[model samples]
Target: MTDHYDAIVVGTGFAGAFFLLRYLQHAPPKARVLVLERGRNDCKVWQLRNRRTSSLNTEEFFINNNPEKEWLMSLGFGGSSNTWWGGVARMMPGDFQLQSRYGVGTDWPLRYEDLETYYGDAEVIMAVSGPADSPMPRSRPFPLRPHRFSDTDALLKKTFPDGWFHPATTRASAPTGTRGICCGAGICELCPHDANFSISNGLRRLHDDPRVTLRLQATVEQVETSGDLARGVSYTSDGQLRRATADLVVLAASALFNPHILLRSGITHELLGKRLHEQMPVDVCLNLRGVKGYNGSTIISGNGYLFYEGEHRRQHAACLIETWNSPFNYRRAALRAERGRWTERAFFRFMFDDLPRADNKVTVNAANPHLPEVTFNGYSDYAQRGVDRIPAMVDTLAKALPIEEIESIEVARSTSHIQGTVVMGNDPATSVVDRYLMHHRIRNLLVLGSSAYPTASPAYPTLTLSALSLWAADHLFTRSA
Candidate 1:
């Protein structure tokens, strides 16, 4: 790493990579940039094929306090984007005004329009595909057309006319540039065709730029701050403790580690590690009579926003229901004979928006202080309202389509969309960062990624988070220039 640089970015996730690329593009020609990644960038192809490798290891630096609720994250150069399912839904307009519109959760410091251009820019760069008629008022249409859905998704769309639509995703439908199109590998987390969007893909180009220095296997221990200014970052590489100075430092390490780094740096706030939450995945299986599910796509197909907002939200939390078009999850070894009749078994997935709670937080474990501990209260009555209404939704679908049987309805898993540890707002007393994403106490320090979210929308947040990062980069560089 350089002795001193114009900017330093920690972590190489969706946010970090976007910020780094933007910063380098906008920064003065002579300006230097350094990126510190905790994990190495080696054998990415091998990791994609094997499923389990050094790149996808469970982070030992953090542990979940609730055994039932796990917070999974990537430790490699690209971070979670390396293994993301590639869903890129934007937050609904109501998502920005949670407090004003619904009288629940905190409102974002900026509105949807403020980030609309950045969303468009990021989407175009990432090659996202979706319908322009999406519920959200976007400034422009997606870069590519929406993916062709499986027969099951088409049925869901016809049955639930008003609520359903093809999802905007990062998966490539047709060959674009050197990136191959999706072959419906069904294993998107490990895309075999290199079609799925990953920050690592961008980092490969940034690595070749002379202005940017990519430092892998370097763990940033703390951000050094002096009298409201961020000095730089201290990280360890090759068993040596090293400190690098920079004019600005951005933390995109993620929701869990970003707060841990701040707390370790002695930057204390009453809500530093508080208000952590994620969209808990709710699972339900159905036995369809004539329709077969699970073809075409692997993970996501389409989604329903009918329950996203209503008078129902006044009493219970809202949820976004999506169709799982991948057959890999529901396949049984003994059921090999039912390959073509795939729609016979189906899984309807629900992502309930988890409210931010002061009690649910990420903190250093008392037993092992070096390892982070996440404490989350599963769900509240708000979430229960969504769960209670699922059966009725199933009944509606059953009546419309060939009826068979409702096999099960239960809490399945989580999307690992860790959010709100270092939330942003206009007021520092109630938040961690300002509207520009700069730290309240440390002016030159900015925290990126989902960690800056005030609340977790019931949809995937990758596109939204990438937009936020680009917004931050524009603000940061425009002022400096």
Candidate 2:
């Protein structure tokens, strides 16, 4: 007994969701699509039981790294989007042209304009909200209106005047109708109120579609390929090996897993696991004596952008000053910095975008389990530069508001949005996928997600990734038709 489909998409994250939805909507009527998800399908149960479980606990990130530390990631229907805080934002035009604007990285083969329409469509599907005019050039109006600011956010806006410019409120992928307000379940774990939108919702819609079939708890072990064409994928499910064949194969398992899968399949292209990009998040916590309502509210409210100027001659870096106050977490983070420090009152988490450097990369560990290994380089210089810019940006905010003292600051690895491995380009020698997201070596294979991003931008990568997936689907459909 063998399973066959017209298309098979791997991974059920944002990229996978977009690909599944677009193919069902636009693929030839007779084309059958099968989505292969390595995780389970229970979003609520996974969120409730394993919400606190660290993503690094599994073989994905923990194999060669330290065993004690727990990384955060959800392996379920929605993928990481299930636990995501749902900060939907578009990349600035400058992000798309980083190579031309600055000599750091390669420019995207496709311009921002080329994907503008798809971005609009993705916004509708995700139900994102933002002001009519955003800062990005050639921007279009959002499908849904902007989300209103909370009471705490309004106070922060009034208190922080300089350097802090409150652009339109960032959008989330949550449900739009009745259940819009966030219950503030510390979205880092899970959205208990169902206010957040993950790919699980999209999967539910396609459950009955005869053209689509979803296989769960099926870990793809090998991609059987003849030369450059992938014939099918072999996997282990229910303690048994199974294989599925498809005319077209899409790798949407994100930057980390996508490269790992390719490496395991023995496709060692020069750029398979190189050029990793991560948006480094830095936290700046302050103790404001008179501020209330900090603990019980949404963590992030508004952000500010500062273009790097003068002698550095580097591309501009953007920083987000998010309003957050969790007494326990803040105190714990503070104590970790300098033992026996009690942090009370308001706090600000400043997330900064570091320019993507080519040195940072992902590789498979040959000796131990062949799991994913990430080596992040070039952060020392960026950290030193952050020390200078962070306080300056804070000082600009202190002028408008009253602050008892700037308590403590810390930087943490951002698991929310990671991009750039298997980047898209016009030339196959320099990139894994071509302009249409088709692998130059394998005509029937496609690579989707922020992995196709040439540079990591300050904004959240989900909306942009969704739009790119739609664009790729369109190209696939046109070529197949």
Give each model a TM-score. Answer: 0.94, 0.85
**On residues 1-481, what C-alpha lDDT tens digit does candidate 1 reach at each position?**
3499888999888889888777877888888889899888745577866674355467567887778777767778778777777888888877888889888877999998899898899888899878656877877888888887666678767777777788888888766674678776576666777788876664568866888888998999889989889999999999999999999999999999999989888888999999898886777777777776666453677777877866666666777877777656633321224556545766778888877888988887778666678888766566767788888877776645565777777786567788889999999899999988899888889999888888878888888888888888889757764
Which ranges in model 2 have alpha carbons more than 4 Å from their true place? 49-71, 137-140, 143-180, 185-188, 289-297, 306-316, 325-346, 357-359, 368-370, 377-384, 479-481
Residues 249-349 of candidate 2 have per-residue lDDT tens digits of 88888887788888888877887877776666666767554444343434444444433222232623555555553444523543223333343345666
Residue pairs in candidate 2 whose N, alpha carbon or C atoms collide under 3 angstroms: 54-71, 55-71, 55-72, 56-71
- The candidate that wins on TM-score is 1
lDDT of each: 0.79, 0.66
Cα RMSD for candidate 1? 2.3
Error of 2 at 16 (Å): 0.6
Q: Give each prediction's root-mean-square deviation over alpha carbons.
A: 2.3, 4.2
